[model samples]
Target: MCTVCGCGDGEVKVHGHKHHSHDHSHTHSHSHDDGLHFGDGAAGVSVPGYSQERLIKIETDILAKNDRYAELNRAKLAAQEVFAVNLVSSPGSGKTTLLCKTIEALGGQPLAVIEGDQQTQNDADRIRATGAPAIQVNTGKGCHLDGHMVGHAIEHLTLSHGSLLFIENVGNLVCPASFDLGEDCKVAILSVTEGEDKPLKYPDMFTAARLAILNKIDLAPHCDVDLDLYTANLRRVNPTIEILNLSARTGEGMSEWITWLRTNLAQKQLQGAAE
Candidate 1:
């Protein structure tokens, strides 16, 4: 598995639509930016014994390198007055669906997307259909988007000053919490179909997020999920996290989501003006 954050299989590869031709035939060495190798003790990288210490060091080094790149990305977004948000969730949590609806609600506001997945540009295509500039970042076997990868993506996307940029992180509640992509906020999405106890189960992800979107609420009547339990669990993990309930499929409670975005955007613009 990927030892960088213990998220996926070996060798994290980035596939950017603007720069790559989707070729998997290239030959290259697989290593984190800090020269640490991936996989589980293979390739003579991991220690034969006392493996926990070695893994800890590797994780530390990788995150340190990732943080440096994240700072650079943060600076770039700040300079442009762009409000960047990272969307993190497990698979089938309705992140892309929410993003598509959010883009539509944005109504041609200056927006761009950085879609992440282990494979496929399907999410990027969906965002593009909403008429927003989008770039797909296939992370190969990686379960998270590091700052270095997002920094490269920024070079290709045309983000306007005071605009909104969304980075849809790979579908995983675990590893994505360890890597920061310099987003202004991390929005964690959990659908009702998923258990209400998810926040309790994945405390790290919930604790890392600044806001929580309890989506697919329209189906709540059909599902056995308890909204109160979800909120309580979320608060238990992150007492200060803001939450918005909505259904992307039916557009229910979308107004509140749009208002939240606009409010954040306005604050960003105000800060930019003051600077």
Candidate 2:
């Protein structure tokens, strides 16, 4: 079990109580650049309700700005008629391998990939081998991909009408769930090696995802991952989330995944034209 599983966990056990101080539900906005706003908690002072209410208003304004920008990004992508899918998962969760094989499965019809990583262009190199236009954004210390980065990436991307864009996000589950990268959908990729409880553990990711690809199915015989339980947990978080199981290395379950993309891409084009 994870160390932060429940109240019985190590950190909570140390205090003989399980009450967490607070989970800061912060969503980044175009307005807020939080340098440091020290509250009264550190000084053991009780602040007035009015001050706290004002702070809450500021937060609401910030989130409203972010929602506006997200809508703008969405409009821009829809106008360009691109089906941008954000790939999110842990560091070694087959994101790059899946991108490599996904491009290959695409057979180069007009696909571009924006690769996000802390460092290196290794994934971009893999993408290049498939003859797709790939741009690497080295976030250096960032934890996730956001709309600003994707909006910037589009300036360099050689996309045409009906081009498929894939933004393989920086490998972090939590922060990425809050940022909208102008994508038509957020695609969460979970591998069998990550285990069945992942969806329940990372409900934010599962909840945000419209579709999920359960990779590494070919390794099922060699591993003890319960596929049924995994699907059940995922469905619990997001009943409408389309699930696809595949292994990129062995080319297992590639056709279904590809077909799903093609179907979505066509539908998006149809919708864009109808508008």
Q: Positional deviation of 218 in candidate 2, in angstroms? A: 1.1
* RMSD per model, one decimal: 4.1, 11.4
Lowest summed lDDT over 10 consecutive residues: which window, candidate 2? 9-18
Q: Which stretches of candidate 2 lie over 4 Å from their true place?
A: 1-34, 37-63
Which residue ranges in model 1 land beyond 4 Å of their true spot? 1-47
Taking the tens digit of each residue's C-alpha lDDT, what string does model 2 give over 16-132?
A: 001232111122224342422322232233334435555545445544655566677788778878888989998788999998888888886688888887666677777877777
Backbone clashes in model 2, listed as residue pairs = none
Best candidate, TM-score: 1
Clashes of each: 0, 0
State the lDDT at 162 in candidate 1. Answer: 82
Give me candidate 2's TM-score against the actual structure. 0.80
- Overall lDDT per candidate, in order of appearance: 0.80, 0.72
Task: Quote the lDDT for 48 in model 1.
Answer: 50
